[model samples]
Target: MRQLYLNQAALSARATTVIRDADNQSRYLLVGKWGLRADVLTVYLIDGSLEAEVKQESLGLLPRFRLLYHRQPVGHVSKTFGVIREVLFVRGLNWVIMGNLNSGRFRIFHGRELIANIAPVSADGQTIALEVDQPDHEALVVCLAAILDRWAKHQQRGLNPLKNRGWAPGLSSEVTPFITQEKNLDRRY
Candidate 1:
């Protein structure tokens, strides 16, 4: 049950973003970029170690991403269309990520059991808290949070976030149209 926070924009995920702990100290980084053949994304430690990675399974058909830990497949993340719009596959855990488009809050669940929470995203950054029963899935949960945040940002722009993945420091989004989710859509009675 390690507590962590995300204070960066995922839609800018083409590069990298530094994540920190509750003390505002840098813990790890989330990176989404291009590989030699296709898109590549992963999380790393400050000492430069691989925590988790994303590998595309098929390019022609539905985009499916495998979550790799130390070069081994542990889980996967796939895009889907639905009324509530479910996305992200939590591999071995068999969990799916879904949230209110109107609310910044997103929850991870293993069937009916609540796993983690990502919420209170501000102009500064988004925060993630994990309560998974297994400790090993920490990194995987973080990556899922990034994927969801990036996906949501793209949704506001009327496009697919999977098509453009990159985020980090010292990168101006002007090169690519970047829009961060600011406020929830207000409804009138």
Candidate 2:
């Protein structure tokens, strides 16, 4: 099981997530595209090394995401039955991200073990907090959070966020703040 935290949150694909250890020393910088020019998610270690790359594989009911470490396939995070997100780690430490995108609340799990939970820490929905059990897996875990985070937004709206959105270096439309409208779907029992 992994328990960690993602603090100082902001609404940006090119993000910097703070993970405070017992002494508050580690941080994970989410480096990726924030515009339409690129399509990739890279999590770089603080020491200036590529930790993991999350690439979108396909577009469908549940889009598939591939985790590449050292240019090798490590695991796969995909939507299960067009609903919950499942992360199957081939190496070790598999996780599952479950939530309702409508509410924007998600939880990470290692099998049945709860690893982390993500929810809006602020009323504006611009900031979020992720609580995880393992801090060492902050890079991989947070990278997955980024992926699942995108998934939640995608689930909320019928449009694909990646198709019309991206993160650039600087001075881009992505840096400009915007509003997200949530569509209220009709649920029949």
Candidate 3:
């Protein structure tokens, strides 16, 4: 298995933005410091739309784990401490749900309704299945790619505020705008 490291600098620079209107008057964003832990980890949902709390579990000198999405926290098999390898998002009826690579589970709430849970399935080497209730695969993929691209750019720039390097360091000028435009289109939907 391949090991992943949490880019502390990138994590600290992580920021998510939510806009409500064209004037950008009602925009909300969450930015904070993040860390990784083997025993217990806490992930905070910054936007006003969601709230989360995570706790460590105990099993006879061993540690158990729980990840709480929204208001409910569920238990899962415990594993050794390591960096978060990936972040995943699935589009539901109303919400763009997020999850980590290890857990492989996500929840989406659209308005007051909770959509179906998404899971991965594989039948052969070439066939991969992402079980989603909605069929907007193109929009979903674009949104996820945009988020990941932003993260990658942040990581490549060393996430140093003092130096404040932009994404030009890692991506070609022509490709960057295309990515930004795609993300903007995704947000409109």
Among all candidates shown, the one with the greatest lDDT: 1
What is the C-alpha lDDT profile of model 3 across 1-189, one tens digit per residue? 111112223323444422122242432222332223433333322235433333444543223444445556432333234524342322222344445433333444446554433332333211112233443332232122223333444455554753564445455464443356888899999
Cα lDDT tens digits, model 2, 1-189, are 433445424425355554444345565556764323226777676777777777777776656777777567777766666432333332244766666665667776777887777766667776566676665555666667676566566556545454446544353664676445332333331
How accurate locally, in lDDT, is each candidate? 0.64, 0.60, 0.35
Q: Give the per-residue lDDT digits (tens) of candidate 1, residues 21-47.
A: 667788778777632335767888878
Q: 2 or 3, which is superior by TM-score? A: 2
TM-score for each model: 0.66, 0.61, 0.24
**How large an RMSD does model 1 have?**
12.8
Give model 2's clash tally.
12
Order the candidates by TM-score, highest first — what do you get? 1, 2, 3
Candidate 2: where are CA atoms >4 Å away?
Answer: 1-26, 34-38, 82-93, 159-189
